[model samples]
Target: MTHYRSFVALGDSFTEGLNDPAADDRGGAPDRFRGWADRVAERLAALDPEFRYANLAVRGKLIDQIVAEQVPLAVGMRPDLVSFCAGGNDLLRPGSDPDRMAKKLAGAVRDLRATGAEVLLFTGVDPRDTPIMRRARGTFAIFYLHVRSIADLYGCRLVDQWSMQGLRDWRAWSDDRLHMNEEGHRMVAAKVCDVLGVPTEDDWRMSWPPRERVDPRVKRREDVQWVRSHLGPWVVRRLRGRSSGDDLDPKRPDLKPFG
Candidate 1:
């Protein structure tokens, strides 16, 4: 069994734990967003009281930004384990090339692995049922293929989100239909533990209950609301060349004892 004395997580909002707010559900600050990385760190801490953890993630960052900003910091920390997940923002942009993005990510992975740390990479979640995301399933698939290949070549642990069938359910996602909800984060934490050979009481692969069909009219109304509340703002930001993380900083910049 491999044990990690320290873990550093890097990437965008997913690593930062965006929609999966902590119990208090406060609006500002990074601690309010306790995500899968935090949960996984908690599990690791249980095994070793001296475990140290750091999360250098900011919301709305593209892969290039992560590589340029977070990658060097994480490498300098020289943790026993590193979790890297980025590029979703790049894929969402118009005319973005999956192959190019994959190349960038592969470079970052190579650097992390060079430190002799056990690196963990994540595949983009399967978006077959998601509305706007479903259209770009091919892009996501192409990127994931490269990710899988990179992990194999570099001898890294992979948490294949695409194979997590339970995640296909709408309930598993936040209302934005982009980031995962608390339940979804919980499941991913267990999956990460499973991949890392960490023991946890929770079962990540339990089948979800049968889903009840939604009325077509209600679904249509919901779609309209989502477009107005979420999509509209997203488009505006894209046009303005602005990012949500423009003024934000990494929540946990230093490796510290965590539980």
Candidate 2:
């Protein structure tokens, strides 16, 4: 097997493995190897046993934040292969705009490609039919399309995460109804390996379903219960304040404010 000297992953929560309820140590340490990026890395290393990998993904990051924070690190790594998975948070808003997200995503692709790395772009699954995510279906679909276009334009390998994981099935996701569980991540990793032309082990079957597939009715009820139980007074207070005004201050001095 040919060896890739370095691998880098860039993106947001899905890339960072946020809210993976099935994770053994959820909400404390980040799910490093549990996410798809690390799973891909694990497969790569299994073949070569000396592959170096770095993950620059952070939870709750938007495309803009990824450009600001993660891009520089990835460029510096000069990785042999770089995998990118992002844009879910950008689609979370009610009026999420895919055109703007596409522009930012294109910029990220350009920046990564400038380093001459072999880029692998991982697209996201749409959880719109899920109780918590139904409203953002359009946004996710648009983002996924744009991401595919960007990958093609930049000459990167595109991993169709939506098709690979069966996004139409609510059971493929974690309890949060957002991120993928261990099985889902494994499926994503398998697809990525396929794109990269990496051989899979005997245990790495391509069509395995998730261990636990929550019934849609039960998932909806649990989603409601989670919102009621987890969304405490402080969260309500914060949300109310956000509702009263625009949370994204156009003149915020900290960020490199958009013109």
Q: Best candidate, lDDT-wise?
A: 1
Against the true structure, what is every candidate's RMSD?
2.0, 7.6
Off by over 4 Å in 2: 1-3, 19-33, 165-167, 202-220, 229-259
- Per residue, candidate 2 scores C-alpha lDDT tens digits across 170-197 of 5556655566777666667677777788
lDDT of 1 at 147: 93
| TM-score of structure candidate 2 | 0.76
Candidate 1 lDDT by residue in tens digits, 1-259: 7889999999999999978887653555435789999999999999999999999999999998999999999889999999999888988887889998889989999999999999999997888888777888899999999999999999999999999987888788898999999889999999999999999998789788887889999999999999999999989999999998999988888999994
What TM-score quantifies how close candidate 1 is to the native fold?
0.95
lDDT of each: 0.91, 0.67
Clashing pairs in 2: 128-134
TM-score of each: 0.95, 0.76
